[model samples]
Target: MQLDDLRQNWETFGAENPMWAIYTGRGRIEWDEGEFFATGDTEISEVMAVLERHGAPSGAARALDFGCGLGRLSQALAAHYETVDGVDISEPMIEGAKALARQPTGVDESRLRYHLNTKADLSIFEDESFDLVFSLITLQHMRPEFSRSYIAEFCRLVRPGGVVFFQLPTHRTTALKRLRGAAGRTMRKVRRSLLGGEPVMEMYGTPRKDVEALLTTGGLRVLDVLPDELAGPSWQSFRYLAIRPDSGD
Candidate 1:
């Protein structure tokens, strides 16, 4: 869909429906002031673990949460980073995020901000301004051509030793899984319907090799590619971590 159409769709969706509750799985009729949806606790915990394993810098690392829906992870990042900026393509998502940031919580509200835009073009933010950049279930939605640019932007936003991470559904694995079971087939049908005979920028299927190639071509070094359900049965997804090569590392 065109950017304007996508924006209008989200705006209408947000205006008529509470985006926060819908996107976060917080229930249709109720909203949870203390919990986050869209991304589950298990995924958040895994992200934190990966960040910690890589060694978060001491005392407030400037961080960026790309595709930060409803500011759930953005709010969490604020607690650890000196400043946390949440960026999303959907204006309603950013609106809900901004609202969440304003609530009186133990987190330092002064350190959080929201931007509405795509990751492929983050012209609003200066280069090398962040210590860490991350996104969850957001990259897969970007068009393949734009995905390359988004990875480049992620690299540009982080300082020379800064880390960047993102998750994408693996096309090959997902397809194989779909062929194995009724539930998987149902999921495949749902996904195909969502595409609706037109290229949905967000529904772009990215394979693991393609994503790794993009990162490598973008001048970032791969640190890891953790399988989504290494320990149990779950959707096939991959999380990638990479760092910008310093002048001399």
Candidate 2:
């Protein structure tokens, strides 16, 4: 999808059902405020534990949560890092995140902040700005070209000795499944052009070898690749863990 179309699609999803768009398991029903954030806490905790075991994220100073829907992961990262930036392609998502952060039970404004970036790369931040560059299910929504650029940007955005972590599907398991995926894409395109209704959610993936090459080309050292079920049973997915060498930083 084009950048404009991606932003527009997320904007509609953000406005209509922000929580469910972030985590479809929540259903279209209203999400319990505490429960929603608690999941974030659990996820971030698990991520940190795994990274720590690998001696990643040389510092705990700052973190960047890309495609941070409503600042769920951003807020969770704040407990570990000194500062956290939550960035999304949708204005409504950023506004909703800011609103949630301002709540009494929400995170401290000084610790967590949100930004709306509709571009293909994260150039707004300086090089090596964050100690941890994190993304979860966010990258799967956009086209691979966009995702590839962001993966490279992650390498630049993270500090020397810091970690870059993300999850993405590799490919469909079977040829039939791949054909069906392509057909679904065509159908979605037709529906959008002809009907002009709500934006449909899209899924994309990168080959495992390409992802490794991207990280290496971006100067990151691959730490591990763990099989993940985040993309569901049909699609083959993996969580990437890589870190930048200190280089005497």
Candidate 3:
């Protein structure tokens, strides 16, 4: 789908969709019984492992999940942090997230709240309000220039020595996939357009060096870059963990 059309659909369906089911699916609301992406337990486990590897704070840590569609990862984070906020640009997504909080998940729903807004501009939050900030499969939707500002904002919102985790696809592997066959090539083009172009977005793919530079330049220290293999079958995607440097550092 074209970027403009996708945005329009999100805006329209965001406010009108009952159950806000479209926010969790591929595009707009197309529900599949027991086949919801947001219900997967592996997502939560992966996120938790990423956080744990990066030394995420426990007991009184404040965390924020950017682009938290339906609050799946946010719900997981709530288990370790004292306070957790999930932010998304879609209102329907937020609604779905809120509804999930009432479920019997053995989690402290009191510590979870969903915010409807863009991560590029988090003015509603005070500076340095969170100890950890994390996002998954979301940054690709932003243009590169905008992504720089978004990362800057994430760094600004996190307290000194805090951690930030993000997962993104790379261009090289994507290009390779395109070369493999017609189906792969077609999917590649579609994904590139859905996500923004390179440098701001991870359309085709991005080199490890470029990704590290972007993170470091945005005032974060690259702590680890777990390659595709480490993430099992999802090796085409990469996970990044970085830390907000102390003021003096």
Candidate 4:
């Protein structure tokens, strides 16, 4: 699927089930702030632990959270970073995030912000603007072309010597699963076109070498890559921690 197609699906998904859209398995349950934000805390905590283990350079003043649905992790980030911007391509998600930010749960709402960006690239922000930028479990849902473009953008927007943490599907599914995936995508397209059903969420995987090459092309130094099996064995995932070269470079 294309970028526009992915956006449409996420917009519909966010409207219908914002929490479940962010974290599946909630299964049509109503939005519960306690449960949803707790899940976000779990993710951020785990990522922070990795960053600490690798000496990823904490003390970040400004941080960017890409594909930040409903401000779940953004709120969690407020404790570490001076300023946190939660950005998403879906307007419904951003609106829900704004409402969540106003709930007065002592999240330092002033430091946590939500932005809606529908563009293919992250041109809204300037070069070397953020101390850290992260996108988790988001780019995999996008098309390969868009995913590459954003990875390049992440490299550009991050400050020199800053850190970046992102997750990518390192390999495609097996032949049998590939066949099933293709058929599912085709049927979803047909159903959406003919029956007017909501857009179906789509996922794509990129090779590990291809992702590493993109990181290099963007002037990022690969610090480490760890296996992450979020999507099961069919689609292997990896978490990459990279650093932008010093300004002297």
Runs off by more than 4 Å, candidate 3? 1-6, 11-41, 172-207, 229-235, 247-249
- C-alpha positional error of residue 96 in candidate 3 after TM-score superposition, expressed in Å: 1.1
lDDT by residue (1-249, candidate 4, tens digit) is 767777778899888887877776345466667878887788889988988886666564789999998888888877778899889999999999988888866377678888899899999899999878988889888889999999999999988878889998866568888899889889988888898757677778889898889888888899889898765567889998888888785
Better of 1 and 2 by TM-score: 2
Provide the global lDDT of candidate 1 against the true structure: 0.68
Tens digit per residue, CA lDDT, model 1, 1-249: 445544554555555554442353333455565644434444566677887887745246898988787777777766667888888877777887787667775356678888888434888899888888888766655456666677778877888888888877665445555455445445655775687432222344567888888778777889889876321233467788988778898
TM-score of 3: 0.71
Worst ten-residue run, lDDT, model 1? 196-205
Which candidate ranks first by TM-score, i.e. highest?
2
lDDT of each: 0.68, 0.89, 0.66, 0.84
Ranking by TM-score: 2, 4, 1, 3
Candidate 4 regions with alpha-carbon error over 4 angstroms: 25-31
**Runs in model 1 lying further than 4 Å from the true structure:** 18-30, 37-43, 56-58, 118-120, 172-202, 229-235
RMSD of each: 5.0, 1.6, 6.1, 1.8
Q: Kindly give the number of clashing pairs for every candidate.
A: 3, 0, 8, 0
lDDT tens digits, residues 181-205, model 3?
A: 3465466567766983421112334
TM-score list, all predictions: 0.77, 0.95, 0.71, 0.93
Summarize candidate 2's per-residue lDDT along 97-117 as a digit string, tens digits. 999988776878988888899
